[model samples]
Target chain A: MCAELIFYSVVPSEEPGERAEIETFLLRNGLSYDEGIEIFVVGREGRKLVACGGLEQNIVKCVATDPLYRGEHLSLTIVDKVIHLAYERGHSHLFLYTRPNNIAFFAGCGFYPIVEVPGLVTLLENSPIGIRRYCDGLSKSRQPGARIGAAVLNANPFTRGHRYLIEKAAESCDWLHVFVVAEDASLFPYCDRFQLMKSGIEGIARVTLHPGSQYMISRATFSCYFFKEKNVAGDCFTAVDLLVFRQWIAPALGITHRFVGTEPFCRTTGKYNEDMKYWLQADLSAAKPVTVVEIPRIESHDRAISASEVRRLLGTNDFDRIAELVPQTTYDLLSSKYRMKAVGSHTSATA
Target chain B: MKIIKDAMAGTLESSDVLVKVSPSDGPLEVVVKSEVERQFGEQIRRVVADTLARLTINEGVVIVEDKGALDCTIRARLQAAVLRGGAVEGLDWSILQ
Candidate 1:
């Protein structure tokens, strides 16, 4: 017999009760909300959310259905809505992660299996021109020895600390792939940030700049840094994102080491890097084996030179103080004819 | 005002209300179904009835299936539905009302 179901999209910021319902259901089912991503849920007339999913960029994640609502075809129903929503938003490609046992279920929903980790996680895509395009772009300029290093940087305005991390990583690896966070949610637009990254690494002979694809700047990772109040997204949040990168992106590019700058003040980032440390060490997959290298932040005037501090100084119109924290390239951008109008939405004092 | 065609506005999603109006000659029939009926049923009915009264709509069958929408969302959606139902042109969506 078929059961009637109620389905709807929710703006968590607008509807607290419905958001709580979905959150409680997800927690009971052993899933966490990837903050900053859009979420949709199916509920009963009484307002108890039973099935739910989130969309971050082109990925559909955190999909969960309450046990009581099983056999109702709720998973596919939620997936279909998200797929239509993605198409409406102009996303031609979509990806999702689920336990290894459910590969056939998603394949039936038109997803092609990409990678299956030994333990329980699997990645699948719904596009015909699937992951090969991404793999080819990742290894665009392959170098020898296979000891490639990877770093995902927003580099809102690349600082000396950023330069130090890349240079430190370059010292040990044959090639370094620096992925600038391409999510337009950043204070500095992607183009300006990409320009700053290029200029920051211009002198490094080994560093190559690439946009961290849709999978990188996930709501699962760094996008929701300041939205922790909406949900308590601990290390597991970043771990999910890093696991996807490790299982899907790193191996194809021959990247053996992932470099990150240590966070001293931001609790969210500090916990995120810590989670990356745990996952990389505990992940025993032959194809997913990776070493996470967290470099000590470069210090200036007894303080860590950081993008957040530069943003703070920019907001206060303290160009001289900002000049000291950033590299010559960023300083040039700040002072040039364009006269970088300070636009960061986030800031933290340097410690 | 009289409803002319079978019309609907708003999504079936939670926190929204879908109002379907069908043309009817029988005494104006209003049927209300709501998720939050225990606490907000009377309020929901009042909003729908008040909107119909403002439109002078007394000759149609109106069905409101509500899912805990706020007063304003219900108001906006019902207004949109009434305008769409009449097959008329003067949809005064100005918030003054």
Candidate 2:
């Protein structure tokens, strides 16, 4: 049977029960509330809210989804509903108080911050409009102690440069959980991107692919957060994937190490690297904190090759340069779909 | 790796390379022999001239034995050779002052 998705506004009779559930869920999820607010739940089947979110008209604090049902972009859906409702009800601006990690997810859904109060994350759970039920169903769906090594790759379609990084990390780990960015928010769709990474690294054993649904829905680390003006210079906002991995995935599934490419290509990545280093050193007391391995950038024509440069050249229809910069298969795949767009077309907006 | 051993030790054959620099003419060049020119002669000349044009050479001549160097490598070796030759005292001081 097709999964039926439903959306509804909360009535006065359900306030006390929903508020209690919200408090319990917030406490269980380590959230807090500071002001009276409103709450809503969106679910696929009756009496089961797959996602929950609400806003405080006075303070603009809202929490959308629990740790479960995270990768489905359910949080974005919930956030979208709340933003629309808030606007329709005569509020020109809406604010969401979120954990620093989930900040990107909210930003992707078009919410911005006016101020950041450290130690205010708990305020979200304690607020009047938070989730009430503290169900462990989401936590139970994930297998504990499942060692997953995650790589937040921009795999501009994998090249030898990318393969080298993956191979290095795979050698040391049992299951390499390669997270593919699924947001169609990229130049290539998630399917094509996954295929390229898989085909490029076909020989590697014990590697599995997970959809970086969190990343696709994230706006904080990319253009979205910047557009929203929620970022701070030294604050170094974390990606939703990294935040989810730390909060929900790492503790729930047991991620031992995180693989990342060297910061030769991106400033966004440089900031991510710094934030991850700080977290690994600080709060990871259960399992050993996450370790980062900088994948070596390959050299060609005695110059270091990068995805950005390749994309730039591709915009000029320079397949020959791409072949030299990337692997043969990557060159072929990129050229077939992207080559036409090269001749005077702009680079992918996501890039 | 081809060997370069011939009767004229300093003179550049069609295959031999003479690398030098002078401040007045930046990385200037004059091939002693032109018979053995290869496929990308014009391109190679342009590459060399274009690369040298960026330098502040007053006067100098450079000769090269390009078996098959891409534009990038040729430029690298040319730049290296000019720097090396620039260090020599009184050999050809006209261009690299």
Candidate 3:
């Protein structure tokens, strides 16, 4: 009755040949395919894979359409299929990320733009109220100004480097927002990390610390990725995670500068910071709302301080050395005989 | 055009509507659940009734779960639901217009 396109849902990893075909398509189109998410494929009876899309939690990603099927609106169909599946699974809130040119297409498909990191990625949600709610909650206590600085920190255990970075940003801005990554995917649970950070910044009144929501989650901090391979496509999570900051988070809070500590130890984190710097400075001819500021690593001896360093020292029973790495509050918590080994660190490792 | 079976159209996405239709022995019945009920309740009913009349379906129950959709969207969804539920033959495309 309709076009001859046959739509099929396939297990991303179970079918080797199909998986390889999807990878080939993504690789050819300058996209990366992340396994473990639900994949939907469309093609004719000839077994020619023409388009692919996937659903991860409530967000849609990894969409690609073959050049031969350019006018068939395959991306839209795959998105609709995924969205319908999410709805069938009882998920009412849906979101997706696409390049700037496809934003209008998804918008026409009942999704509205929530944030845009122009020329990179655009985040859209199925409902307008979802983003409007975040904006409302953000503006309730945020002071309006161009000098307000923002920092998103996982602070696995809150270290001296974290304090130093916060101090630098706080010194420059009248208001500083510290969003502690709240995903319970690390050596410390989100509750423990939040508590440690709260005690760590007890005296810094202007530097208000907030809990990072799902949108700012790093793959290292999301438990779902603890089993999945990381960075299958190097910059997958970078574009999606930061889109929230660039579009909705920073703007509603009137944050003009985003501060990140330079990385000298972990390559993953270092790459994330580098990409964050580029995203903050990208399309500068348009003068985006927030500019990224990279502060040199807070060092101890000859090495830069990091949460991974502290975690590595935890298993060695060297409390003294670990003490040197973190702030007093983090040290107190780490030394209380309550400790756990951290999983491997992944940067921009968000889904 | 009477509904002979069950059918659904549209979705729960915002600015959209999920319409379900079922054959009934009673007169035309349409119920609406909308996010903007206070603002669009009457309008939604009016548009639904007009759409049912246009489609020539005089005996069926239509359930509309709206997420702030406009009149045109409601009409479109109702049309799809009616066509899918029954109306397999003697369909007049001009009347729907």
Task: Tell me the tens digit of each residue's lDDT in model 3 across A1-351.
Answer: 545778777677678788788889877877767665665554443567777776666566677787777653566566666666665555545666666788766654557676664465566766544566656677776975559999988887788888888888888988999888865667677888888878877677588888777567543212232123343344544655665677677777888899988877667667777777765667642435578888998778888888877777876757889888887778877777455543343333211
Q: What is the TM-score of chain B in candidate 2?
A: 0.53
User: Residue A199 error for model 2, in Å?
Assistant: 1.5
Q: DockQ for the candidate 2 complex?
A: 0.00
Worst 10 residues of 3 chain B by lDDT: B5-14
lDDT of 2 by residue, A140-161 (tens): 3343344557676666556677
* DockQ-based class of model 3: incorrect
Interface RMSD of candidate number 3: 7.6
Ranking by DockQ: 3, 1, 2
Ranking by lDDT: 3, 1, 2
TM-score of every model versus the real structure: 0.62, 0.47, 0.65
Q: Candidate 1 - CAPRI tier?
A: incorrect
The better candidate by DockQ, 2 or 3, is 3
List the RMSD of every prediction in angstroms.
15.6, 31.3, 10.8
